[model samples]
Target: MAGHSPADGPGDGPGDNRGDDRGDGPRAACVLCGEPTEYPAEIAGSPLCPRCAWQQAQRSACSG
Candidate 1:
């Protein structure tokens, strides 16, 4: 078989969100809750709002 599968089409690699479509738009909402966030939507990775960020930190802290 080939190195890549047909299902794994172009731009399907990890962290490949195809950000070019955003085109420098306004700030992005939280990826989890869809609330307004302070980070730019064009950022490479997901951006979380204040509440979500705090919640995520708490989850991580307690996981260990």
Candidate 2:
């Protein structure tokens, strides 16, 4: 017990407290929804809320 520490368990270490690992870069949440954004390179006007992005995709597919 004397050699134990909180960091030894899950969600207790420095890495666990830092949040998702999207590499060493700044992070921003979606504009429409409040979720973490990923694959920023593949997305356009990304960080868009899921609801808005889905609608945009639907419109694009329909027009094509």
When superposed on Cα atoms, how far off is each prediction in RMSD?
A: 8.1, 8.2
Per-residue lDDT of candidate 2, residues 1-64 (tens digit): 8988777766734466655555746456687666666634345664765667888799999996
Whole-model lDDT for model 1 versus the true structure? 0.77
Candidate 1, residue 62: the lDDT equals 100
What does candidate 1's lDDT look like per residue over 1-64, in tens digits? Answer: 7798755666644456753443355988889999868777667789999999999999999998
lDDT of 1 at 48: 92
Task: Look at candidate 1 and give me any clashing residue pairs.
Answer: none
Clashes of 1: 0
The regions of model 1 sitting more than 4 angstroms off are: 1-25
- TM-score of each candidate? 0.56, 0.33
